[model samples]
Target chain A: MQTPSATLVSRFAMEVASACFVMAIGALVCFGAREFGIGWGDAGPQPGYFPFYVGLIIVIASCGVLVQALLQRRDRRESFLTREQGGRILAFFGPMLGFVVLSVLLGMYVALTIYLCSVMVVQGGYRFHKAAAISVATAVISYVVFEVWFLVPLLKGPLEAWLGVH
Target chain B: MENFGNLMDGFGIALSFYHLALMAAGVLLGILVGVLPGLGAPNGVSLLLPLTFTMDPVSAIILLTSMYWGALFGGSTTSILFNIPGEPSSVATTFDGYPMAQQGKATQALTLAFMSAGTGALFGVVLITALSTWVAQFALKFSSPEYFAVYLLTFASFIGMGSASPFKAVVSMMLGFACAAVGMDGVSGNVRLTFGFTALISGISFLVAVIGLFGIGELLQTMEEGLRFEGLHARINIRDVFHAIYTLPKYWVTLLRSALIGCWMGITPGGPTAASFMSYGLAKRFARNKENFGKGDPNGVIAPETADHSAGTCAILPMLALGVPGSATAAVMMGGLMIWGLTPGPMLFIERPDFVWSLIASMYLGNVMAVVLVLATVPFFAAILRIPFSIIGPMIVVVCFIGAYTIAGSTLDLWLVLPFGILGYVFKKLDYPIAPMVLAMVLGDKAEDAFRQSMIFSKGSLGIFWTNSMLVASIMTIAMLLLFWPLIGKLIGRLRRAI
Candidate 1:
């Protein structure tokens, strides 16, 4: 029998991982705050004094979470994500990452066209022409609203340069 | 009476055709965003903030607050029609609103919800009108210690009233403080918590954080849920609407009680979401037909809607009078206030009476306009929910990123949205309250400054927090009580059990 529907990760594991992540951030803050002395100077608190204690509290709180998560036996068996849910999340997240990367490389308008068109066509199972029309329409509308009317310039790449639409 | 005269002046300024047009546009846009899941009031207001950058502060605030009122109304519509809360505050509305719709009383439920919300909002504005002048005048007497105590009270109440684990709340709040502490220290001139990224030299933009967390992050969660809206399309008949309006006074007790709960929560930072839930619980507990609560009781629809709107409207009072935002949306607007070179404390009332009063006057006009506009536009918003998620979802993502980029025109902010989106998604799933985090980030520097200033005044003595003045001492005592509220509650529970 295939195990395709198996639990991908347990809730307990995810909890532990997140707690560790918070703890790491807290440690980093504490470390960084030390650069500026975290003590009270003659005048008052040094720049880092507030942040140092803030970091320490974070560490302590996350530690509490970690300990609590470990002791909760009932939560250990709960599934954080099943294989199907994981696939669904990745399906949505993968395109999002691509959109960000493409927006950076090509200008945001071009990226918007590609991203919207692809997501609609591939995931939505829409006809390609319909997706293209919608995507192109969105880009044009956004251009009018933001650039023409509002006078806020967005990021542009070679396509806009070639079109002389800067 | 002086306040009444000031309000009349505010009306004279706000009655212009230009401001009225802005109010209508803001309300319509507000409804659109509010009807859509994952784009709530905070996200809508923040997204619209950049557009208001060029406008005068009075007009800018009028637009934003109008949108806010429209959003609160729109959120309940989705709850009734789709059993999905478009905003967090409207979650309680779904308890009875959806069932009422299913029972084919959509018109009645919608009418009652809108009426109650309008009534509640008006009550909140009236409260603001009466109390704001006095509060602002009182706040003018506050020094650094008093300011610190007020900020402390705000944070402590969040912990006391928050539904999330206290430890998790602490972690979320401290993380925000850490983020705020990044970039440079204004007092010491030494940059702290940047971790050596040149891009971070200008500190974390709370606007970007909001867009990422509330906007993109919410979209991610919606995606994971694989949400598909199947809304009940109701053609709201005018006669039925009129009939429902005629019946609004039957639930006067619920309306009045909920307005009070909403006002208290708003002033104390328990926020609209918590206020709505609390109001719903109380309504259910006290209802004559408790069994009808989850089965489409009209009071269920009325209670939460009233509280949600009242709390939302009243939350602005603290933001204006105390410079301590009462809600996430208020925090974002307070940031916009600073961006416009307008400080948000008691000084604002004396210094820029026009800005403060006009905004107050607009609240009276905006809510009335919101009620009229929302009732007329319900079917249109419902039609929008028919758009497939594949199309709408990606469009929202694009909107979010564009909003982020426009904040500073920095590509780095665009990248920042990614990790923050992940953090937001995870934090939400793990039951962390994101509001405190957002508030802390916004108020972090100010709170830090106040604390540091107090310490300097007291020569680094910790005792100064409570020993300074009777006002400061009493405030600190209240803050401490709130901070330990959970434990105090437990102790009381044990005593009752023993008795």
Candidate 2:
């Protein structure tokens, strides 16, 4: 079996998928517009008037793109992403997801430190102490810039509350 | 004459120590970010826009516009020294810049590029002084019909001028309008399209969308390629700067020609990138030393640099006077204007004279600052390129996430960043342009409002758009332009062949 990283999605598949997504959104918007009343009112045109045309245009354009994608021969289709590139994307995506969750739970400063250190260690293969130093430095500097100086409120968690930083 | 007096007053504010300091800091930040791979002026401006919330609108615009100047200037250094353009606009600079660097005149090439850029920028500011006021005055007569027509012209230009398929561009634009529609319908007082979600009641924040689509989206895209920067070493001495300045007056013809081309391109919405390439090609064809054009010709570096900077600066004129931003970066600035509660259009010229004129004056001062700052700190900015993308990539994401969160100070914004980021990545990979999306999101509400008002005024007579002589003439011009699209395509194709 081909490796996940090496797996390729055909261009036709991507095009059709995107086109279908657009068409679905278009249909939903159009349905909403009709319900909202797409006509002239006593004071002015109804609120839905502009949206109805916008939705129609989207559906028609998406259909055209859909047809274009479907009619193309298999040999003519281009490759969207190679398996290796896909793997590399997921490598970044996984940590980003983790970082988002961590920030939600642990606070931005704490999460940033961990995120940077982990990236340095896992991705760049740096020593733990060195990674920690840089991460700490970055987190502290960002804290000064965004929190202290700017005085902008930030989303924080237990760690910040414990440190009395927030 | 009154314009001059106002410009003088504008200079009064622009020259203030606080404004000057902000301008310098912005240019410095701009150069650093522009030097980084996968970051440029629009991303820099959008990322920093949240910080400007506490500052007055004048200082805010000065800072952002200065960043634009610095980014354009910094873009050339990489192009000249390393043949790595920070953005597409600088790609033309690489044609002769790298060759000159290879010939060991890298300092001279950088200096000439900076000087030519400053000259072109000054020229664009002069155009603003001479032209924008008249346009603003002219726009004062406009009613909703005319306003709708102008909006249509801006949208139609994207369809006509873009390299993307017209259908796809429209789809992208429609998607933007759909996102815009989610917010409360201002007229009806009904919160349409919210789908009953409490968070959806306020709608998708354009600032959040920008941060997500550009900042986080870009970070992911950069990571997908791993490490890609192979930066060149650069050094510039005082002697090289003086020598380059001394030799500048000798290429006056090329300079003037390039400046005019830049001005035309910027105002016509040809965009800086296109202007740069078109100028470079024209220079090569027109130069007296045609045979030596590619072989480290200094004029080769001057033409594109001048055109690119001029186009970038002059793009603001249309953005300021018409509310229709001509470039993606300008669109971000327009979004900033909206966020700051300033409706950008001709009315701004009347209502916010100090803000508008001071921004114009700051463009002049900022270009000077950009040149001085870039010349002194080339090696410093270049060193940033040496850092691994693996390290830089995650840091940018952190900044983007923070920026997104701080917009409304909620975890919701953090979550909001991802889907938009993913969409941006997909759009970039699919070669569907993202500029139209951002522009549409920003202008969709205003355009729709204008259309509704126009219909009311016309009493549902579709002919109202053509009722007045000026409106009729304007609409006819746009129609003629659209009608001749096929002919224009063929002509452009033939020209490409001949070239």
Candidate 3:
């Protein structure tokens, strides 16, 4: 049998994790609120006054959700994502996440072409030529719309600069 | 009378060739937005928002609002043909619509749906002309405390009426509020939540949030399903159109009732989906021959379709008059208004009568255009539905990335889009209501500003919220209702159990 790590994360586990995550955020907010001063100043309520209360609400509410989730029986909770579905989601998500990093390095237009082509070919099992053509077309169309027509400049890199385009 | 005169002047503005052309294009695009699953008014509007930044305010509002009206019309098209409801508001239509189609009355059913939708929207526009000016004037009396109370009321309504757990809604809303608190603190000129990131000198872009959460997030979710459309074959000639028009008079009572239901729900916070469901149920209960209902009944199509369109149209009223959006789409429109440097409220009427009235006029023209265009272009939209997700899905993501990139033209916005997309996907999967998050993000900074101003005026005394009679009454009512909301939920649960 596979180890526990190989099993799908259940709804209960996800809920618990989310609750913990929110609590951490709540704590961070409360800490930040403290630094900003949560009390009323002579002028008025301090900057942190509203945020402190907001943080407090999150903390209290998250604890309640956590307790409710924990008390619920394992079999009673619905599956958040079965292993296969999780893999399928990750198949797209992982590449998309990497696409952002790639866009940062390669410039947005070049990155867009690579991102679209790879997603279409690798994920959808399309041939490389069709994927490349569509990706190139989409990027060029975007350039026309945003750069040429709207005149809104997008992020560029070495490739764009080397081509003597602003 | 004055409102009518203003509206007439607005008609003059909207009838110009530029505005008319924009309306036609907007409606056509809107129909495509509504017809495409995983795309809706929010994403469509968000995607087009950057483009609108180039147009004059009158032309921009006309374009965006026309798309909105077109989306409402297109929502019912797929429901009647296939059992698929393209928009959530159209879900009620599938019950009678698909059955009517199955019974080979697809033409008549489609006609009834379109006609009723048109009638309902026309009726709602008339109501707006009668009521909105008065509402706007009433809102002119509001101060910061009153404004804060109104914002509170809007947030509380979301919590109380939300299908998600109230705590979850609050969590989502607070998360949005926290996100809005990032960037600079307008009051102190100190950036509190930036955590030392220089890129966040400007606040979190509402445009980016919308594109990521709705557009990219939705695309990601669609990819999971690997959605393939099986569109229904539909055809309508002029004869069928005339026949549908001729038969419209028979359902006058249903049309009137649904329009009223739609207007009431839209004026309140029920939104289009609830209005449609409520109108359908009410029509069934009050129908003269209830036995014939749900079995290819034309009135069944009329009721939901009318209410959905009316509610969608009338939802703009709250956004215009009170600066409170009655639905997610209205919230996005309100965002658009703010981005244009025009804050929506009573002041909008006073400050920009031309803009306000023309938008109202465009609503009339937009609805008419939507009905005509939708009726003429059903086959084209159906053909679009046949494109497989493998091709369309990546294209959608590319568009979303482009839309996100247009926000401040920073790649920083693009980086955040994917994460927000994941957040949106998870929230949707976990059944968290996203509207409140979006609305809160839009309102959070403004609400806090209002609260701070109010506090300064009151010399940091919290009693100002209670001491003012109008604020007291509204705030107390909303607070008590929200406090008892769990009890109400429990009571309803018990009642359902008993039933």
Candidate 4:
């Protein structure tokens, strides 16, 4: 049977592994950039050279640490994240991920309205009417401030043309 | 006499209605942000920068500078009234301040904190007023090697003071340096990190990164913890204020020491956090009621409050004199300076005396305003804690997204915000110090530019760094100290054992 300490160690090992995976992807991007004929001094050095090297280093270092953490002996300790704590992380990360997806499809204003309302309702536990009212008002005000008054062309997706914002 | 003339000119600009109004607005907004936990001066200033696009350079500088001072003052308010510190720099105040509040000396603690902050700010402003010219002249001597040496010192200190393992700090710092290397290479004007995205050409804005790292990252943290506000019910009476003032003379030595430490730390680029910690530690060791230090000593609150404010104020010195920002807030201010097309350096004093001096003078006025405003409104500000965090939490997230998008009018920026927020959360969980990462990110490109420039000048030989005695000495000293840190730690341990 696995001990509690062993479980914690295993969890930490998994996290290190995930971090390494991300770093590996970053390294691939760097390598691909290098292969695309971006040299250190081409046109004063391509945009990818420094960041490429940096990403490569991160991958190497992250892998080393991942291996070290996996091989380390387990020590008994309390879990840093309990199930409840994990739930809280998901509560935040889930809606945020949804917002990013929505933004691309629904446009910034509509997506913002939905995002704000959901957060206020789900995370804040606000009354439906109050959260909905606040969300809509905030989005409108921001649109006026940034788009109309400042003359910044906010990213208007196909939906905005459908809605005749122009 | 020359100093007097410069100050008079500074006053003329500062007293103008346009500058004065901007300064007042900055102070008010700064206080609001600084009083809120997790929103400190840097975030506050960065958030407000876009608003300054419409402002004249002079008005913008005054506003941002006043905000910086106000944030420093406001940070101490929460530490005195509640156990929570509004910012990292105010952490030391919570040690003794909250205990004093618990003992029903809330008014006295608030008054002392405000007054000390004001005094420290005044000292810092005066130092800048007096020494800026000399400092600028001296900083002009700095070549690329010298700059790289300073950058090295900054990273080294993070490792020295960080709670995280040295390896983690180094890795975090390298990550920041790498991030800084994104966009076009400064020396060669070649794009290095864009990875074929045209949007990446202009490069990632430091403001965008800062907004994501501090603003969005903080929202993520709050979401995880389920934001909760603890309210305080206390009436601040005038009698307590007077009582604190009467007792002020008793802690004169502590006050002076703290002010000096604050000024030194500010000038050296360590900033308010270092000054506050050093001041608090020294105060605890030397205070008359040393045993009662942690429990609640008035000196404990006074020392940190004084030092933090002073350091915050003095950080402007390097910005004005050398165009080198000592802190993140100052970096944002530098951005403002560049937007206005006014280069911050020795010429700022020579050519734009009105702008430079007026900003310095306003610090004097702004500090007084902050003290009076905070003291009079302590009860009102403390009542903010009574507001439900459920409402505040969602509001903060909305603001973070808007702030990010507003920087460039791009959803890509807003999208980047979440990943950085997660990164921040991971760093926090791992107990890695974020300060080094931030400092390195802000200074990394400049440091790299300096290194490469020096190499080019020396025909690709690294020996140029040693050719300059100042650069050689500073670099060698820091390298030696960092390499020998374990030995120093061991020696300190031995001394403790012996004692």
Lowest lDDT block of 10, candidate 1 chain B: B222-231
Q: What's the interface RMS deviation of candidate 1?
A: 1.0
Clashes of each: 0, 4, 0, 8
What is the DockQ score, from 0 to 1, of model 3? 0.52
**Residue-wise C-alpha lDDT for candidate 1, range B291-339, written one tens digit per residue:** 8889999999999999999999999999999999999999999999999
Please identify which of the two predictions, 2 or 3, would achieve the higher DockQ against the true structure: 2
| Every candidate's TM-score, chain A alone | 0.94, 0.86, 0.91, 0.69
Candidate 2 displacement at residue A112 in angstroms: 1.2
Model 4 misses residue B274 by how many Å? 2.6
**Candidate 2: residue pairs that collide:** A5-A83, A5-A84, A6-A83, A7-A83
- Tell me the tens digit of each residue's lDDT in model 4 across B123-143: 888888889988877767777
Q: Model 2 Cα displacement at B315 (Å)?
A: 1.5
Q: DockQ of every model listed?
A: 0.81, 0.67, 0.52, 0.34
lDDT (CA) per prediction: 0.92, 0.84, 0.83, 0.74
Native contacts conserved, per model: 0.85, 0.74, 0.44, 0.31
Residue B275's C-alpha lDDT in candidate 3? 90
Docking quality band of candidate 3, CAPRI definitions: medium
Question: Which is better, 2 or 4, measured by lDDT?
Answer: 2
Residue-level lDDT of model 3, residues B1-499, one tens digit each, is 7988999999999999999999999999999888876677877888888888877988999999999888887778888887777787899999899899888888888888998999999988988888899999998888888888888877887677666677777878887787787777878776676666788878788777877787767776766655566555887777978988998998899999999999987877678988999899999999889987889888899999999988888888989999988887888888888988998999999999999999999999989888889999988887777766666766777677777877678878988887778778777776677877788888888899989998999897777787766655677578658746876879999999999
- For each candidate in turn, the TM-score is 0.98, 0.93, 0.93, 0.88
